[model samples]
Target chain A: MSERIVVDPITRIEGHLRIEAQMKGNRIEQAYSSGTMVRGIETILKGRDPRDAWAYAQRICGVCTLVHGIASIRAVEDALNYDIPKNAQLIRNLMIGAQYIHDHVMHFYHLHALDWVDVVSALKADPQATAELAQSLSSWPNSSPGYFADTRRRLADFVESGQLGIFANGYWGHPEYKLPPEANLMAVAHYLEALAWQREVVKLHTIFGGKNPHPNFLVGGVASPIDLNSDSAINARRLSQVQDVISRMRQFVDQVYLPDTLAIASFYKEWFKRGEGLGNFLCYGDLPATNMRDRDSFLFPPGVILDRDLSRVHEIDMHDKAQIQEYVAHSWYNYSTGKETGLHPYDGETQLDYTGPEPPFKQLQVEDPYSWIKSPRWRDKAMEVGPLSRVLLLYASGHEPTRELARFALAKLDLPIIALFSTLGRTAARTLESKLLADAMQGWFDDLVSNIKRGDTRTFNEALWDPSTWPETCQGAGFMEAPRGALGHWVVIRNGKIANYQAVVPSTWNAGPRDASGQSGAYEAALQDQHTLVDSSQPLEILRTIHSFDPCIACAVHLADEAGDELIKIQISG
Target chain B: MNALKSIPVLVEAPATRDFCYQNTLPLLHEISHALRRLQQEQLPTTIDLNAIPFGPGDEQRLLEFLGRGEVSAHLEALGNSSVWESGYPGIWFIEHRNESGERVAFQMEITTLPAILATHPDDIAESLSSLQKALENPSLGHRIGD
Candidate 1:
């Protein structure tokens, strides 16, 4: 008998998603992954000032708002060819780095932890052992015996209070909670520590953005103007705070994250070999200089992997718009054959035929097919992006720090020195990346400070060429390393105003639909090998594990009421 | 072939937290009128762009400010902070609480003609001068908030 298992409204991860897996016996025979919702972000952007898109783009996804903000700005700058300032480049880099650290921490603890480590299992943990684990790590007082004792008390309080609002729907003490009582105790302690630190560190963004989730970085220069006097004083505090938070986080990664992942991963050593997606990885390089790229967009050097054969990723010029096309033959968007990125919106040529096929990634079934995301391939090949890609690129380029971090992390996790290119290697890869980036932030920070001391703190460039400054009226593509993965924004301009703004989001690449061939999107392919589903009610654990791929679907929600929907006139019917 | 005595350009606001149709609804007619008046003067329109395309942030500190996050996603929605919208990078600050006790998050919009429309070099110089003057000085007659 065929059983239809619908994991509707997949929670915890960003955006609205539903997974339909046809079960044959105990295994999932086929899968249908549907994002199911659509927001008219592209349609709304039509006929607006191009500069505003930078401000507009951040709303795409909370998980990677910085990516959206940068993508939008890069698109406009790519069209204008406006040179960004060096100080601004460092600031952007730091901000993006913080975002990566923040996102990964959240992805691990708040989202993915509950899947492996049971929340209720903490009750059975020996508080003394937990305290011992904490105190043994650098003799830190924050995780002392007293702290664990109190943490145990708080857990009791939470259960008694019935105000376990955050943990309301949690599947605590589930049978699959794999770990020793002592390890669970340690994990519970660090979970709280990570939460507090995550909240504390986001302030860096607030000081600059006036808020955090989606910060505002001015395109040409820094947004918060340096009132030389105010900056010297305020920056001292801000910079110190950033360093302190980063160091604290580093300790947690070294002491807690590494230990927790290993302790837990050891219990489920089976997963160490499963869920590797596509085998083809892609990463657009980061750390763009102030000048950006001239023609080939040396900003994010593309990194592509076809099967096992890896190639240096290159930018597809927006001028040659024909090269970058998205085929929705199997997507929710039913186009008239193949539609280019410049025109792939719902209204443009969308055909909503749910009758297309199962897991649309399988729709083409050749090389780059499967998934709802429009399979975004550069030069007709599937590519992988994000931490692994970054690590690989850094290693290939002989970045010693990244290589060292990778080696150290592998040693701790008891992972083989296989150069970190496996399905189960994502966790180690992300951890090592966090270390590399945390260290690099200091390097970049010192560089910026030295440059500042040398009297080179210019922040913006006003492009007013010798009368022949209409920017040649051509198209340009801007690719940047979003905290999540490969994020690219393509723009085609005609006579100054934005003619087309195409954003192939990180989620679009990672959680994309199938390409022309029958290859699974990154996330879809990753889910195929999963033989475990503890409880159907909590697909969240699995979703969290899958979403660790860091898929940010920005245009998943759209509220298109009558044009005059009095938004703030709260008719709070008491 | 142009007998346009009085023409007004309808400039739509970017899909930002502030300047959304929801927040600016009460004064839509006024904004439309102000936009018409600015077009007659021929200046680049001052507008609010949508800083975020998704929901508001789960935590307020995530609402970093550049030029965006100046508006609140809460005020733009129907309920008390919908997760779908709030999960996006959104913010809404209360300048003054409204009548229903639901505070209004607004954008200070100053619509002028496009700055690039100055026909001559002197005209361009004059246009920039006037634009800066307008930015520094908000016309009392076109005032947004009370």
Candidate 2:
């Protein structure tokens, strides 16, 4: 009997996402990934100031707050051919570096770790054994038995109260939880430590951009002002604080995050064989050098890997209309032309035509438009993005640190190179990327301080402040290697206003619905491949693969209120 | 450390009437008190947003006042639900919806971690039974649970 197991709202990751898998025996024969919410933030941007687009775009998702803001500014900057000051570039790099490290760490310990670690099982773990295990992993100072004991006590308290708190809703005691009690306790300890650590780390953004979530950004440069002595501006004191944040970030990633990932990953080596979706990977490389135009200067090189080919890399031209397109066939959206045809971002149309069944329906009409996420394709193929893609691109392009870390992780895990293609590999890739970025952040930070000392402190260019100097119309794309994947924001500026705006974020590329060609997106494809549910009811196996993508449906779609009003004014104006 | 000590305090964005929702002030106060209780007792509680009748203005004010923290999650497992941490620690906003993607439930889960995040034991037990049955009868085509 083929049973359909639905894990709607797969918890922990960002945003609302529903996964329905059809099982033949215990193996998943087919799967459907759906974004249940609809947030047409781009529509609100129409007729708004292009300079102010970042402020609005940044609201797209709270978790990936700064990525959208950065991408929006880049889109406007790219459209105007604006060149920012060197100080601005360095600060931007520092800000982005902070985001990658912060976001990736949170995802690991808080979001994705629960799939492997059994929290309830931690109650039985001996603090001494956990300390021994932690010490064996790395010299991370928090490996003392006392630390583990405190974490255990807190867990016991939460358990005794019958309120598991965040540990609630977890599949405790499931047969799939392979980690021992000691390992779980250690992971739980780090998870608590990370919550506190992140609070201090976000101070970097506040010091530089004046606030954390959705920091102020400007076209042609960053919004942060530079003053060596002024207390209010980016002064010497703030600079040192930024330095402090960087050192702390590096320590946490190297000591806690990387070591914990390897330690926990050793237990789930078989995961390296599961969840290899759409072997194609794409990366619009980020962390630029002196010149943003020069792709060769990017620390993480931009390229595409087709069919698991490590020998070659493909160029991704953002301007090439034939290269990237979005399909709305199986999505709750409609193109101006029709639902069957695809449209590039330059001509992207968002007509929210939700054709799915009304609420309270047990199962989605899988044969129809069931998801709000439009299927995005590169050259008519589903490509997986995020840390795995960036890491692979870095490795394929001979980026030294990426290759070293990837090789080191593979060696430490005793897994083959082919293992990098699976669920565990994807999670490990995020940790590895965090380490690489943490190291690279020092160079960017040092360069910024040196530039300031050498008497170059200009942060923004007022040259492009006036719209009258611009042409009547222009279109450009801004993309970055966001923590999740390749996030691109395209803008068509006309008459000094945002005429058309479309943001193809990371989750859209990875978590989108099936395209017109009926090819499943990364999440669906990965879930369908070699996924055998040990317990159809528990479905830990399904969550393992989907969560590996660190699925962020909030980035893909937006909040659909009670009105069931799907279309947010699909005004397709030429 | 000397340089840091002399640094001027950064000013926050001024409270403007443009974003304030006066009607929700009472509710905001209630939420504030709840948050205080959460801190004082280390007790987790749920504030069902759906239970309170809110106008559009009230909703806007609640969001502006609460702001957002670093972490948020959308769980589409059994239903569509959003779990976002508010600006305050231990204050989380959760919105759960049915299949049509309408908010069937909205809550402000005040806890160390939102209770909805962990899979309940009953759910696992039910799932275990379902899997056992599925294993016992692979040819049974009927849907087990709605």
lDDT of 2 by residue, B48-142 (tens): 77777674346755777778999988887655888899887778898887644546778788788888788789979988888788889988634
RMSD of 1: 20.3
Deviation from native of the Cα of residue A403 in model 1, angstroms: 2.9
Alpha carbon deviation, residue A196, candidate 2 (Å): 0.4
- Against the true structure, what is each candidate's TM-score? 0.69, 0.78
Worst 10 residues of 2 chain A by lDDT: A559-568
Docking class of 2: incorrect
Summarize candidate 2's per-residue lDDT along A245-328 as a digit string, tens digits. 988999999888998899889898889998988999999988898756778888888989999998999989887878999898
Report the lDDT tens digits of candidate 1 across residue range B14-102.
35535322333433444455556656864323333243232222112122312343223232223232111121122212222342233
lDDT of 1 at A242: 57
DockQ of 2: 0.04
Evaluate residue A314 in candidate 1 and report its C-alpha lDDT on the 0 to 100 scale: 39
